[model samples]
Target: MNTFLNPFHLMKRIMLIVTLLLIVSCDGYQSICGLVIDSETKTPIEKAIIKTINPKFKAYSDKNGYFEFHNVTGFIFSDNDLTVVISKVNYINDTLNIKNGDSKLVKLIKTE
Candidate 1:
């Protein structure tokens, strides 16, 4: 039987291609989450701005110092490094190199 003429075989091939595409595309997006805290005081730093430099995604730390960015783009399986900047008033800015789907604890020092 010619494979092209077989409806079931064609369907299977199409599904396989679609499945591969989905798997490959899944690696391109990821979520980032972290907590911001005062380095000296060990206290949560609220209202801190957290952002990714390359993709320009931003989120603010809540009262609990938790921030998250969902479905951020440009992160693939091979190159998943992201640069994050965290800043708040009176606090020295912090820069971090983190991977996609990472939850990190960040500490910021207060400027004298």
Candidate 2:
């Protein structure tokens, strides 16, 4: 009989299949974690609104100007373009490219 069809080969195939299944069953999600800061003063900007489209997701900066959003599907199965909009009261809206699974530094300019 061919060694390829032996029980060892069969067991190996089953293990391979199980491994693939486990990988596919994992959560297909991305995340964006960062801090929002002032363009000039370089200080943290609290209460900033962060929004991303194409499987839309939103988050707000905390008192330390830190923001994070998980389970992001930023243009995953679509176009390569991903946009992130950061805005706050009396501040110039800052538009940035989405960087999945990375920490970013978002700067906003104050409008007067």
Candidate 3:
């Protein structure tokens, strides 16, 4: 007994495989998580507004100055182009790049 495969089916299967590979390998989304701290005192700065400049995402630091971007977390893969802007009253504005899946500590200096 011999088995035969249809050429159209084979082409469709190849196209589907290629599409799936592209979808999985493509960089889709990104996220940022970090701690906002006072540069002088070395203490966590709570309630600071952390906003992404490009994608326009926003979050606020907790009591420990820890903030996590939930939207970014939703994505499984991302590149290295995420910037988070940290700002608070009486403190200097700061910007940080989220990279390497590492948590960053952003220090803000108080203005006189």
State the lDDT at 85 in candidate 2. 90
After superposition, the stretches of candidate 1 with alpha carbons farther than 4 Å from their true spots are 1-27
Encode model 2's per-residue lDDT on 1-112: one tens digit a residue: 8988999999999999999888766655677788999999999998899998666788899999999888775333433445789999999998887656778898888898
Best by lDDT: 1
Order the numbered candidates by TM-score, best leading: 1, 3, 2
TM-score of every model? 0.74, 0.67, 0.72
Compared with the true structure, what per-residue lDDT tens digits does model 3 show for residues 1-112? 2223677777888899999998787655555588888999999998999998776878999999999875553234545557788999999898887763568888899999
Those runs of model 2 whose alpha carbons end farther than 4 Å from true positions after fitting are 1-27, 74-81
lDDT of 3: 0.79
Worst-scoring 10-residue span by lDDT in model 2: 73-82
The candidate with the higher lDDT, 1 or 3, is: 1
Better of 2 and 3 by TM-score: 3
Candidate 3 accuracy as TM-score: 0.72
lDDT of each: 0.89, 0.82, 0.79
What tens-digit string does per-residue lDDT give for candidate 1 at 1-112?
8979799999999999999898787746777899999999899999999989988998999999999998888736656678999999999999998887789999999999
Per model, state how many residue pairs clash: 0, 0, 0
